[model samples]
Target: MSDLARPRRSVLYMPGAKARALEKARGLPADSLILDLEDAVGPTEKEAARELVVQTLKEGGFGLREVTVRVNGLDTEWGEADIRAIAAMGPDAIVVPKVNAPADLHAVERLMDDAGAPAATKIWAMMETPIGILNAREIAAATPRLACFVMGTNDLVKELGALHTEGRAEVMTSLGWCLLAARAHGLAILDGVYNAYQDEAGNRAACRLGREMGFDGKTLIHPAQLDIANAEFGPSEADVELAKRQVAAFEETRAKGEAVAVVDGKIVENLHVETAKKLIAQAEAIAKMQAG
Candidate 1:
């Protein structure tokens, strides 16, 4: 699958300090996994978590799931060491936290380069600070290795001094800015995690909102939330059928030297055909990932 088309429908966060969690993650149905060495790890466990995460990556049993390591902020004591260690390991990407500007990414890129990280490993930024939201575009275009934005809504809410309402009214503007930047740069973006893990309805509702807001997927806090994220973000059977119809109808119209076709009483144009084809490709990619 193309890098852009790789399914990120359910990106679960697995605490790097927990060996059982890391082992369990290999069999989880998540489309992507963020092996977290930052917030999830207690301050006393930082070095241990980093070492454990490195060992887990070396073991490498995650089949087809995009694995990324979320390092602590560079300002923190463990951040530099985390980057130097993770960069050398070369997971799919190295996630940087609280990236306030392009300079943060550049700094991390330098550390990555100094560590001799492989070219295949990309960088994913956490858009959590107000300055980061304000400088979304520059961060998105910061480095060639930058490939994704992972929303850190919990930190963002705290940073904004705003409440986390059900509708996320407080953070919609911030989300929009990052989304625009990611799309503008052709990078994948994920929605923040839904905290109410036990509330299936609430989690589903949040996933629906994220999907409607054009998020490629959502960061999940628990394994239980994986199914809902996958279902809400991936193309449904009805959507796949519609895409197939739109593609076929557009081809037929083009054969007749026409510029438009109608599908289900809606006019389909070249732009719609293009979108339909992308949707079809995404669905196929998801299927292939699931099959593996």
Candidate 2:
């Protein structure tokens, strides 16, 4: 995917074992759909889930949203089979849970190779456990195939013995560390899902908080959360206007052979110009989608 093209602001997780949810997800407004074969599917249901996911991809009518499969961890009995199945289906990405080191990624890479998966089948890592947080940078920097980090806050909370406070203070350090690693490696990072699927107010608050914390988007549990997540992550009208003004001001300065420009009493530099351009581009993309 192009770095310039913003991904689906809300990535909905559909239980791979549930064919109905998988089919329903195709009509949701979520930017991406994650067919989960991990925590969502029990051991007995894993094989069934894999088959359903593979069939869904083969059927191929998911609209503009990207598709991904969250395979069981490599340590699990079904992990290898999940990888092989996913490779055959050729979804946009494969999400690996609880990745602790570069070696974990290397193992998955080899599995993908053996399956003859296309190079475009990227890998997304879950930064959840304490060890995963500690080695987040090393794992993110491990290979070019690493595309993104999906925060697994529930696991992190369990590992840290943390209570769910309003601001999530207990897990702030790990979240920050994960963001740092993702940005350092130029990878997209998503905030974890909010467990209360029907709590609209809480989900909106969490989405806003994730945006403030520099997450590219938020993983979602239900389609009800899609609107809020997309709104929070996407550029606002005010943001687009400011970006346009900044670009105009900067361009005028450049034409005058000046390297810097003052906008609304604030000095704007090249960095500001770059940010404005990105904002405008994102706004345009969103507008096009809305128009369609």
Candidate 3:
């Protein structure tokens, strides 16, 4: 299956400066890893970290975890260098943080192209600033290579001068806007990381909330958060079974020249069947990743 259709239930962040952490990411169960060069790296170690990230991506110990390098923003001194360096190694995607407009994506795409980045290498834009939240739709549709939006909630909160409540009450409007934009443009949207890594209960609750918010997954700060994120976002066994039944019933109806089918005493339409097929495909993709 294509990476686009693969389940991205838990995307963990690993600091770019830590060689050991990068090496250890190979064993994590997270669906993807953002090799962070933005907030995670110190200014003094930016260049060194960039080198390490590039070397690490080329070294290739990261199993099925989709590797994406989160570069510093174009406005930063290290941003261009980070993109140019990471482009050479060609990680799955280059994540640009704090994207305020489509012009931001356009600038990054131009840099990636100039750096000889492969066509398959995608761009993951983070919707953080208030301007970014407002312009999400334009940004999502800005580039054909735009793959997903990684919400930078910490920055967002700082920008809005809003409190980080237990349920992210202040951030709901921003989240909802970005989610709508992503869905409208056929792009994947991942929820922001829960800051309280020590609070497992809080983390789990937050993950559940993100799942209920129609997020494909949640960005994680610690590997310890993976279990809850995966469980909450990945299709449950019961859900998979129901999806299987729906798909079978719909396929049978299609074979019989019918437009609809009844599954579990409920009417199933074409859209329902489509959802079922996606569920099954996602499950299969996750299974394949886990098997390896």
For each candidate in the order shown, give its overall lDDT on alpha carbons. Answer: 0.95, 0.88, 0.92
Q: Which stretches of candidate 3 lie over 4 Å from their true place?
A: none
Clash pairs, candidate 3, are: none
The TM-score that candidate 3 achieves is 0.97
Residue 243, model 3: lDDT of 97
Winning candidate number (TM-score): 1
**Which runs of model 2 end up more than 4 angstroms from their true locations?**
1-4, 288-292
* lDDT (Cα, tens digit) per residue for candidate 1, span 1-292: 6679899999999999999999999999999999999989999999999999999999999999999999999999999999999999999999999999999999999999999999989999999999999999999999999999999999999999999999899999999999999999999999999999999999999999999999999999999999999999999999999999999999999999999999999999999999999899999998888888
lDDT by residue for model 2 (93-134), tens:
899999999999999989998998898888999999999999
**Which candidate order results from sorting by lDDT in descending order?**
1, 3, 2
Could you tell me which 10 consecutive residues in candidate 2 have the lowest summed lDDT? 1-10
Best first by TM-score, ranked = 1, 3, 2
Clashing pairs in 1: none
* Winner by TM-score between candidate 2 and candidate 1: 1
Clashing pairs in 2: none
User: What are the C-alpha RMSDs, in order, of all predicted structures?
Assistant: 0.8, 1.5, 1.2
Q: Give residue 72's lDDT in candidate 2 (0 to 100).
A: 97
